[model samples]
Target: MACMKLGSKSDAFQRQGQAWFCATGLPSDIIVEVGDMSFHLHKFPLLSRSGVMERLIAEASEEGDEKSCINLPDIPGGPKTFEFVAKFCYGVKLELTASNVVYLRCAAEHLEMTEEHGEGNLISQTETFLNQVVLRNWKDSLRALQTCDDILTYADELQITKRCIESLAMKASTDPNLFGWPITEHGGPMQSPGGSVLWNGISTGARPKNSSIDWWYEDVSTLSFPLYKRLIAVMESRGIRQEVISGSLTSYARKYLPVLNRHQVVNDSSSRLEPVGLGAMVSEEEQRFLLEDIDRLLPMQKGLVPTKFLFGLLRTAMILRASSSCISNLERRIGMQLDQATVEDLLMPNFSYSMETLYNVDCVQRILEHFLAMDQITGGASPCSVDDGQLIGSPSLTPITMVAKLIDGYLAEVAPDVNLKLPKFQALAASVPDYSRPLDDGLYRAIDIYLKSHPWLGESEREQLCRLMDCQKLSLEACTHAAQNERLPLRVVVQVLFFEQLQLRTSIAGCFLVSDNLDGSRQLRSGVAGSSEGGWTTAVRENQVLKVGMDHMRMRVCELEKECLTMRQEIEKLGRVKGSSAWENVSKKLGLKMKSQMCSAQEGSVSKQKNGNGKNRHGKHKKTFTPDPEA
Candidate 1:
């Protein structure tokens, strides 16, 4: 701390209880009563340096009052600071520091101790020390600003608060390392000004090399909210980066808002300070206002703040009972960069009194809507584009795809909540555009979870929820799960079977294409018999997994074929009783028979191919069946 000694003389005042009497052995000519304390002194020193005191003394004399007492009921800093002022007037030794400079300045201003009363009055002396010593140092400036809260009106009138805030802002905006100030990253050891690395006062003898922009966050976080607000405005007006401002805001919130420390969202940096207990440091109402103010001050740009931090703010907002607008603003911001959020970030527990679900499903739905709105406004180009009259996938869909996956995972997490209504579940599932999901595996899992938790959903309701998934997009594993899942509507299981069969056929056709290519290669290199045989053997070795998969798929298709046959037989029996409607329903719902027969024939031919070898006269193996070009 910076200190300025004002008086050269030894202490010449004695305090007997609340009354301080000068020790010059002269009868007291004047008494200045400040709150509970009284200063008894001669008139010469008080009259020379204090304009207000001189006028009060003259006014008392003019009123024909013999008493020489003057009461300073509204004196800034009250009796404690008045004691310093009294000592200065009497030329007793007095030391002024950053901690007390603001108090002395405000008190001096209140007493009208200006240069007009003396050559170098208390006001001018404090101002010079503040400008030259206190404001020039980072910690000193913060300390001075913190002291202004007790005498806000006087400090504002004298511009001490403004000067201190501006000084702190200037220092905060500059790189602390540029001027040899000790700098520390979040959660790292704080370095003392003496260049010693300190963690609870243990020296590690290691100095940090690079400085972070958050070096001033801890220092400035100690200021009162009003002063901090002014400092932030000044920094913003001076063109400080938004990211820096955001970091400071996050730091301040972490220190002052206790809920953030308790929330599940992982902060980018661990708070360097301990969690402040609610009602201990700030009242609940004050915390609420602080959160709203911080929300208002956040940068409007996207990607500048972390999504997790936004979630933390939102959770805290709900706990603090912040204004509706503040909560909405947080949701919009979260939506703007929602692709960066994880499932855990969106798992905010229901805080409403209604308590409809385990998690706030409706809030997440709104956030998803905001994300979609932003995507639409930015002309979210579709991931698929036409090339040569055929649509192809593009990388432009990365963000929406990520969000889709994130939402699917979130849905699965909330699916177990029985209180989550069916419509709400369906709405959230359908929020992401169809184009965004190239694969429905994640969506299927979530839907399946919802179905498992909600067994009471009727067949029609289950089908309606299942419609959100495109069967063609299901991975083989999901297809297998869906095929055996009795909880799914029978119609959905049929669709899953049909798509699974179709996907298997496509795989078999691909294998046929590769076999044809290999055969062509073998024919072309027949003259090099050893090389040809070696290459053929290597190709077969590489495709062993594909052949195994084909075998499993062929068996699955055959089982589906038998299932279709059984279903057809049952439909025929129903048609005899229910007229032609059952036949028509079979035609519409069980369209898998023809494809199943095709798979059967293909499997038969493959079996025949393995059992019998078709060798030419030259003893070279020959392909027995011709591939259908359409296949």
Candidate 2:
């Protein structure tokens, strides 16, 4: 049910006013409420337009409710869209635009306003609107597809998603530089200095609640899986690599890809070359365009090409009757056709096909054949070649070298899905050069992804694989973790830091510090075969560091002793210059006399004491009679 500005054919008349619909000056029998909006109108028109409304009215009457209002909870659109649908049902001409077309179409479909009674009705008009207006512009079509929250349910119900995708695809393929349209220009792409402009308002861990994701990055989050696959497939067919597309979209979803929850009833359309189930074989002109699109990808990184496009290219090749033709001739044709841009765009990945892609796109196989064919066409083995092992290897430091190492580990480590994944991985590993040192950030990341997928791996096996990693490039956290592990030798972990100072000192002073392990200290120290139990034993590493420091301290001690002796001699010479030696001799004699008197006092004799006045050496004691006379 929708709330529109219902006018009189009733006992009262209403005009468009700034009050609530129910509060407006209209005498109405029934009030229909949809969300916060209410439509005060006669029940007759609603019954005629919507069976849903008719059923609600019938239920209300049976319940004999005093309120003659029917409330539609959980309806699709807001009040504005409902108003548009209401007016359309009342025979009002609807003005459709890209902004409101998707929502309006769904609203019409929900209200059953599209069921025509011969003449052109709202539904027929909507169909015409879609074909004539929405389908014509790539921006409008994608906007409708992504902006419409219920597009999957509504578009699926109306069976328009596939049609919309098809139309969008046609428009996209016709454009130059098909993938970067709207964003890309003759010089560059439309992006902020930092990244895409969409990254401005939203960031990681922050998004508005209750609002559907609307940015280009999050736009795909609302699409069904099949629709998402179709979108990617179609774009790739136009010569847009998945890497470019995914990289652009990944700006908002920076850490990872947004998970899109698809509708359960989404149709499964598998047997098609193009996305949206476009027929397998395109027209000859279209094929030329497709071939031209494939031609554009040459001279670029082969890894940049999405497997889906490879599949589409292969499918097109098969349909063009080129798959069965001599691949060498095809290579010659490619060279002849694109002399200026001739380079190997397609080449075998170092890893297995399935591991490289979500679907079994045989991207690796096709690239290998292309490379091989190019080699044969040129009449010489390519820089990369296939050996007797069916393994592909190249001397250049291409991305495949790293992928080969990854495949080797992935095959040996992962066990559950290995049956479906083994042969390809084995071949990839075999292709890797024996002397190839896997020591890049990407290689480590690939290894991490593989190990994370298999949680039950034994510790020793994990350690062995990880040992191959370049410790210098390891992250700070990884270094800390490796240092803490009991299995790894402390020396090895410390050595991985590659500190020249630590190695230099440890190499020289083998056992300067006290050793935690006694027997090992003797073995560790050079020229010290005899072990001293519970003595000044030190580890081999700490020896050099301590010896240097301790030797400097001993030399410093000798210098300090010489300085103290010189200061003492200077003090004695100053005393002699002042003639204080005579006072010293007198004081020494007086001290000896005092000491003899103290010895006599211990034998019950009185000892004399000297004062500053030098009058008496002893003080007299008064007898009892003498003290009385003196008082």
Candidate 3:
């Protein structure tokens, strides 16, 4: 809220003549000047109606030498609005119109006119007018807001921006498509003033201007954060994409800049406004100031800020897409939340998207650090653990899935994006096991980079990497990746190179399966990951291996797939028929659950793997130092 600080009051008995006060038909004591108009009214009414005025009169009385009249020039409410306020105070009933309502509301609030006092006071009457008439009708609300443009400095003092935005946000959420942007037009470079660039990698700035009136963009920028956040949640619920939301909000950072007052109309039939535009961004100094305000919010109120004025003792953190410090506060708040959580609340999509901005801003290392620390304190598996690969929808997997998704997105979208060339896949690779690998070409690329950089990692890691290379999992690209790898152990290379040939044969038996739903997409695994699997690269790999060097690799994959299928079938039969000769072998192969052990079932079952790739195994790769020529 902004205010005038409404200066101190004084009184003197100079006795400015009672020209207007005499017309009131009552004994005139004081003449108040507001703008060009003079109100000749009794001091008692002013004393009773306004607390501020009463205090001033009391102080003036005690000062001895005093002006007989109070001259209030340039009050927040202009003469027209004051006329209505004076009439209301005199017990006169006037029809409330959209044009005067917001102004009256602002004037009432500034005068400290109490809302609880009912319609007798301007404040209470204004509230009724807004709720019952203005806000309920879109046209009426628009009209009310149009009236506000010229009087923003006054309206802002009364915190009217939030109310106006709430009404407009409802209209926006009702039909987001009405904003009239083509899908292709989105994600355009967000441009600032003078053709300066913004959202440079991660920070965002402003929306470009055009001849067409962009009402939604303008109002969205004018709103305070609480109202803006509500608008975001509403728009999202309407299924509007977050990119559009982020793009629009880029203007929020520049809302404080001054703009031209050229008359801009709202709709064809109705109103006009000041020239509307928010530049790309504020200076670095303002960014820190605003973001610090948000950062210094208490832990609970970081996202949940409540408006209690005394809370001002707290520091302010900047709150903008471009403010690094603003982001750090949120990251710290998240860390605090995780420390106290009973379950995997961090897996929530809202939380994920909040962090996405952090990633876009290139602040994810701090995020990764927080989650890892949480994992260490929690000792691995969350309280709500997923069983084995047989179960789906386990909350425990949410954290894992979130991290997997983060890595999957990093590998797929961020790493190769020209603006974000992050090359830290080695640490990300080591964070999760290969069996837990989501399906994506980036997975293959990330793993390839990690292995190439750490060639000395021992046999165990190479073996896990081999399981990740399962024929079904391998796109032609993934296959080509393995073929190009000079570091794979002898046995692992044999498994990967031979996969496609084995899959063709193995699927004929009931042993190999690719889900029909999944078959159309990830033909190998997860939705996000499997989208780019094996089309061009796999086709080329098949030809290269057949013509030159795949004979031995094909034979090895075939033998391995055959052996695993036979052994699995034998184990199933042994479980069915007690006393079968293979019982001991099967039992040992599928380790028994000890008393303290729990049954683990993994779900969202990808197609059943024909090779023994379904088996769960976890291990860190051993490494021997190999000197790099550059080092």
Best by TM-score: 1
Per-residue CA lDDT of model 3 for 1-631, tens digit only, reads: 0011111222211224433343455566665777777776666756666666677677767777345566666556576676666556555446676667787787777666774433356667677767765665444554566566657777767656556656666665554355442222223555422121234442221222233334466545544444455556656666654445544543443343212111423223222233322223347565455445434422332223222211111112222233555556556555433323322222222123345322232334455566566655665433342332222544454565456545554544333323322234345445544434434444666555545655666877666664443344665456555544556654444344345334433442322132222233433444455535546466345434332322332343344445444434544565477665565655444333210011111110111222222211122222212222121
lDDT agreement with native, every candidate: 0.76, 0.43, 0.46
Residue lDDT tens for model 2, 163-211: 6677655543443333332332211233322222223332111111212
Model 2: which ten-residue window has the lowest total lDDT? Answer: 607-616
TM-score of each: 0.81, 0.34, 0.35
lDDT, candidate 3, equals 0.46
Ranking by lDDT: 1, 3, 2
Best candidate (score: lDDT): 1
Query: What lDDT is reached at residue 206 by model 1?
Result: 34
- Residue-level lDDT of model 1, residues 1-631, one tens digit each, is 4477988788888899989888887888788888999988877898789998889888978887656888999988888898899889888889888878888888888888999999889999999989877777666677777878778888888888888888777766676456563455423547544233455675433334345678678767767777788899999998899999999998888877877777545444354322212223458889899989999999877988889989999998898889999999999999999989999999999999999899998889889999899988887746564332233575556788889899999999999999999999998998888878778899999999999999999978998898999987887678767766768876677666656656555555555556556556656676566565676676555456445544554565556556655654654555365657766675554445544544554565465355231111112122222222121
Which residue segments of model 2 deviate by more than 4 Å?
Answer: 1-26, 51-68, 78-80, 90-94, 115-120, 177-230, 233-302, 305-631
